[model samples]
Target chain A: MIEFKDVSKRFGHTVALDNFDITFAKGKITGLFGPNGSGKSTSMKMIAGLNRPDKGEVTLGGLQPQESKISIAYLPEIDYFYPWMTIKQAAGFLQAFYADWDEAKYKDLLGFLRLEEGMKIAKISKGQRAKAKLLLTVSRRAPYLLMDEPLSGIDVLTREEIINTLIRDYREGEQTIIFSTHEIAEIESLVDDVVFIEAGQVKLAGSAEDLRINKGMSLLEIMKEEFRNAN
Target chain B: MPTSRLGMFSKLYSKEMRELAPEMITVIGLAVLAYIYLFFKTHDYPFAVIGPVFMIGGMAAFLPVISSFKLLSREWKNNTVYLMMSLPVKGGMIMGAKLTALLSEYVLGTLIAGVSGFLLIYALNPELGQVLTSSIPGIGMKLIELWPQGLALYLTSIVIIAYIASISFFSQMVGKLVSRFSGLVTAVVFIATAYLSGKVGDLFWLNIDKQWFTNGINTFDLNVINQFLIINLLFSLALAAVIFTLAVIIYNRKIEL
Candidate 1:
C-alpha cells in the first residue's frame, strides 16, 4: 500500500501538490486522471523516490519511498535510459539492481514488442522507445508498478501494444499498479479504479465500474463533466 | 534471483568507467600524439620538448578535474539521472563507483604522461641517467637512488587527485539541489570548499610537530621530504574521506529530480 498524507510540494512559487491526500490499495490497477501540470508526474516521482514532499509524507508499505524502491518498478513518461546503452545492455545493468527481474519475461516482451535487444535506445523511434520503457518496467515482477503517462504522445499502434502488454502482464492479486494519464479512454477497461485530479487535488475518485453505473457516462465523459463543473 | 553486493557495485563501476572512457581516451590520445611528435621533432633541440611535455602534463592533470565536474551533472543533462536516481541502492554505492572511476581516470592519465615523458627524455639523451647521478649541487644521486622519495611523490599526487575529485562531486551535488542556476551554484560551492580546505591544510602545516623535523630543511635530507609528502598524503586522504561522506549524505537525503 502506498499512502500520501497531506502532501504538498512546490517549485519556487508554484505549488505542484497542494495538501493532497490519497491511498493506493494493494493488488489493484488505479488510474490517476488529470490534465497536464495537474501534478500527476509529481505524484508518480514521489513514489519513485525521485521527488520529495515539502510539507507531508509519502510511504510505501509503511517504509519511506527510498527504502521501498526495490519493490517498485517505475516507467517515466520521458526517455531516461542512457543513450549509449542498447536495450540488452540496459537490461543487464538493471538486472544487477533488481532481483525481481525475470529474464524469460523480458525476452518474451522483447519479441512481443518487436524490439531487438541490440537496438540502441537513442537510435530507436519515439514509439519504439516508449515500448522499450514498458518492456523494462514490466520485466520486473515488482510489487508496485508505477506508469506515469505511459501512453502520452505515443502513436496509436504503439499505445495499443503498451496497453496490451499491461493487460497481459498484470498479475491480478499480487501486483499493485498506479497509472497516471490524461488519455484515460485508452486504459479505461484496464483500470479497476480511477482518481480524477485537477489543480493538484483529487476532484473525484471511485471504482471504474461504480463511476460508469452511477454517473451514466464513460470515464472520458466523466472527466470532461467533472473538470467542467470544477471550472 | 538475488545479486551479490560486490556484483552490483562492480556493474556500476564498469558502467561509470565506460561512460568516462571517451574523455580519458581523448586526453590520453592527445598526450600520446604529442609524445610521438616530440620523439621526432626534438632530436636536435632536446630540451625544447620540456615545454610541450610540461604543458601536456598540466592538461592531463586538469582534464580529469573538468571531467569530474561533468560526471554527475551529465546524467541530469541527458535525463539519465532519472534512471540513476531510481536504482535501489544506497547513495554511498553510487558515489563510490563514480569516485573510483574518476580516480581511475586520474591514475591512468598521470601514469601514461609520466611514463611516456620519462621514456621520451631518456630516449633523447641516453646518458641522462648518468649525468643526473654525477651532477646536482648537493644531492648527487642516480634516478634509481631516489625511488623512496619518488614513490612518496607518486602517492601524494594520487591523494591530491582524490581530494580534488571528492570536492568536485560534493560541489556538483550542492549545485544540483537547486532548481535553477545549477551551474553557477556548483562553481560557487566548489571554490568555497576548495578555499576552506586549503586553509585547513595550511593550518595543519603551520601547527606541525617539531619531532618529525628536529633537524630542519638546511640539511636537505631525503627523509624530511618523504615525511612531508607522507603528511600531505595522509591529510589529503582524510579530507577526501570527509568530503565524500558529505556528498553521499547530500545525494541520499537532499537531492531531488
Candidate 2:
C-alpha cells in the first residue's frame, strides 16, 4: 500500500506536486491518469524515492518511500538498460543486486517479449527496450511496482502484449501496482482504481466502478467533463 | 538469504568492469599498436618497449576519471537518474562499485602493459643481462636491479592517480548537487582549494628538520626520508578515502532529476 499525505514538490518556483493526497490499496492496478506535465510521473517518482517531496511524506507499507525502496520495483518512462549491455547481461547484472530477482521469470518474460538474449540493448528497437525494462522490473518480485509511462511509445498491439503480460504474470493478490500514463483508454479495462491528477493536484480519485456509478458516465467522459468544467 | 559483503562488492565491481570493457580494450589495443610501431621505427628497444607501458599506464590512470565524468553527467542528460535513485542500494555502494571497477581496469591494463613491455624488451635486446649489470651502482643496486622496482613505482603512481580520480569523482558529484552552474563552480573550487591548501602547508614548513616533523616534534632521531614516504602515502590514501566518502554521501542523498 502507498499513501501520499499533503505531498508538495517544487522545482524552483514551479510546483510539480501541490498538496496532493491519495492512498493506493494493495492487490489492485491503480492507473495514474494525467496529461503531459500533469505531475503523474512526478508522483510516481516520489513513490519510488527517485525524488523527494518538498513537504509532507510519501509512504509505502508504513515506511518512507526511500526506506521501502527494496520492497518496490520501479520502471521509468525511458529505457534504463545500459546501452552496451546485452539482454542477458543486463538481467544478470540486475539479478546480482536484487535478492528476490527470479531468473526463470526473467527468462520467461524475455521469451514472451520476443527479445533476443545476446542482442545489445542499444541495438534493439525502442519498443523492445521498453519491454526489456518492464521485464527487468517485474522479475524483481517486489511487493509494489511503480511504472511510469510504460506504454507510451509502443504500438497498440505491443501495448496490449505488455498489458496482458503485466496482468497475467505480475499481478497477484496483495501486490500493489501503480502505473502513470496519458493513455487512459488503453488501460481502462485493466485498472481497478483511478487517480486523475491535474495541475499537480489530485482532482479526482476512487474506485472505477464507484466513479462510473456516481457520475453516470464512463471514466473518460467524467475526466473530460471534470477538466472542461474546471476551465 | 544474506550475502557476504565481499561477494556483493565483487559482483557489483565485476558488473561495472564488464560494462567498461569495450572502452578499456580499445585504449589498450591502441597503445599496443603504437608501441609496436615505435619499436620497429627507432630500433631503441628499451624506449619502444617502455613506450607502451607508459602510454597504457597513463591511459589506465586517466580513463576512469574521464569515464566517470561522462557516467555521472549522462544520468542527468538521459533522465535515468530517477530510476537509479529509486533502487534499494545505497549511493555509496554505487560509487564504490564504479571506483572499484575503475581501479581494477587500471590495474589490469597496467599489468598487461608491464608484461608486454618486458617481453618486447627481452626479445629485441638479448643483452638484457648486460643492461641490468651495467645500470647498477653497487651490490644493493645489483640486488634490486630489474624492471620490478620500476613497475612498483608505476603502481605507486597509480595510487596517486587514483587519489586524483577520487577527487574528480567527488567534484562531479558535488557539481550535480549544486545545479548546472555548479559543475564550473566545482572545478574552480577544487583548483582554488588545492592551491590554497598546498600553499598554506608549505608556508608552515619549509623543510624545517624533516626528522622532527616525521617524529612528531619529539623523536628527532628517526630518518626523515623514510618517514616522508610513509606520511605521503598515508595522506594520499586518507584524502582519497575522505573524498570518496563525501561523494558517497552526496550520491545517497541525491535527488534524481
Candidate 3:
C-alpha cells in the first residue's frame, strides 16, 4: 500500500500538490485522472521519490519512497531511456541494477510488445517507445508500480496493445499499479478505483464502480464534472 | 553496506566509461586528423610538425568544462533525471561516478595528446634521431632523470582538472534550481569558484615567504620542493572536498527534476 499524508509541493509560485492526503489500496489498479497540470505527475513523482513534498510525507509499505525505491517500479511520462541503447543492451543494463528484474518476463514481454531486440531506442516510433517503457516497468515484479501518461502519445491501436499487455502481464494478486492519464476511457475498464484531481487538490476519489453507480456517469464524465465543479 | 556500495559504483563507473568512449574517440580522432593535415601542409619547413602537434596537446585542456557540463545537463534536459533519481542508488554514488568518469576522461585526453606530441617530435627530427642513435643509453638516462618534474606535472594537471570540473558540476546543479538565467548563474558560479580557489591558494602559500628561495642554500633543495608540493596538494584537496560536497548537497536536496 502507498500513503500520502498531507503532502504538499510547490515550484516557485505554483503549487503542484496542496496538502494532499490519500492512500492507495494494495494489489489493485488505481486510475489518477486529471487534465494538464493537475498534479497527476507531481503526485506520481512524489511517490516515486523524484519529487519531495514540502509539507508532508509519501510512503510505500511503511517506508519512504526513496527508502523503498528498490521495491517500486516507476514509468515516467517522458521518454527517458538512452537513445543509443538497443533493446537487448537496455535489458542488460537494467539487470545489473535491479535484483528483482525478471529475465524470463522481460523476454516474454519483448515478444508480446513485438519489439525487436536489436532496434535502437531512438529509431523506434513514439508508440513503440511507450510500449518499451511499459515493458521495462512491468517486467519488474515490483510491489508498487506508478505509471504516468502511459498512453499519452500513442495511437488507438497502440493504446489497445498497451492495455492488453498490461492486463495480461500484471499479477494483480501480488502487485499494485497506479496509472495516470487524461484519456480515462482507455483505462476505465481496467481501474478498480479512480481519483479526480484539479488545481492541486483531490476533488473526488473512491471505488470506481461505487462512484459510477452513485453519480450515474462514467469515470470520464465524472472527471469532467468534477473539474467543472472545482473551477 | 560498503560492499554493495562499491559494487554499485563499479557498475556505474563501467557504464560511464562505456558511454564516454565514442565521444572521446571523436575528439582524439579529429585532433589526429588535424595533426596529419597540418603536417602535410607544413612538413616541408623546419621543425614544423612540432607546431601542429603542440596545438593538439593544448586544445584538450579546455574540454573538461564542456564535458562536465554536458554530463550533468543531459539528465535534466532529456527528463532522464526521473529514471536517475528513482534508481535505488544514493545521490552520492551517482554524482561521484560522474565526477570520476569526467576526471578520467580529462586525464586520459592529456596523456594521449602529450604522448602523441612527444612521439611525433622524437620520430621526426634528423638531429634528434642521430643523437638518439649515437647515445641511446645516455638519452635513456636523461629521460629517467626527468621523472620528478614529470610526476609533478601529472599531479598538478589532475588537481587542476578536478578543480575546474567540480565548479562546472556545481554550476550545472545550480542551473536546475533557478527559473531563468541559468547559463548566467552557471557562469557566475564558475567565476566565483575560480576566484575563491585562487584566493585560498594565495592565502595558504603566501606565508611561505621568498626567504626560502633567497636563502644561501641550494634553490632546488628537497625541503623546498616538498614544501611547494605539499601546500599546493593540500589546498587542491581541500577545495575539491568543499565543491564536491556542495555539488552533492544540491544534487540530493535542491534539484527537482
Best by DockQ: 1
TM-scores, all candidates, are: 0.96, 0.88, 0.92
TM-score of chain A of 3: 0.98
Query: What's the CA error at residue B39 for candidate 2, in Å?
Result: 2.4
DockQ of every candidate structure: 0.83, 0.52, 0.50
Least well predicted 10-residue stretch by lDDT in candidate 2 chain B? B217-226
List the candidate 3 regions with Cα displacement exceeding 4 Å. Answer: B1-7, B38-44, B126-143, B213-218
Candidate 2 Cα misplacement greater than 4 A, ranges: A170-172, B1-7, B44-57, B78-83, B118-140, B143-155, B196-224
Comparing 1 and 3 by lDDT, which wins?
Answer: 1
CA lDDT of each prediction against the hidden true structure: 0.89, 0.76, 0.81
- What is candidate 2's DockQ? 0.52
lDDT of model 2 at position A124: 84
Candidate 3, B1-257: lDDT as tens digits: 11256667877777677767887887788777876676566656638787777677766666665778887777777776777798888778888898788878877877787777666666556566555445335233444454675687678777777878888888778877898999899889888888987897778677877687456135445566666675677678778878988988988887775
Specify the highest-TM-score model's number: 1
Decide which is better by lDDT, 1 or 2.
1
- Clashing residue pairs for model 3: none
Q: What tens digits encode model 3's per-residue C-alpha lDDT throughout A1-231?
A: 989998888989999999888889999999998999989999998888887999998888889887988888999989988787888876766666787888899889999889988989899999889989888888888888999999987899999999998889878768889999999998999999888887788888999999999999999899888878777
Candidate structures ordered by lDDT, highest first = 1, 3, 2
* TM-score of chain A as modeled in candidate 2: 0.96
Model 1 lDDT per residue over B118-169, tens place: 7888898777777756645576666677778788877888778878888999
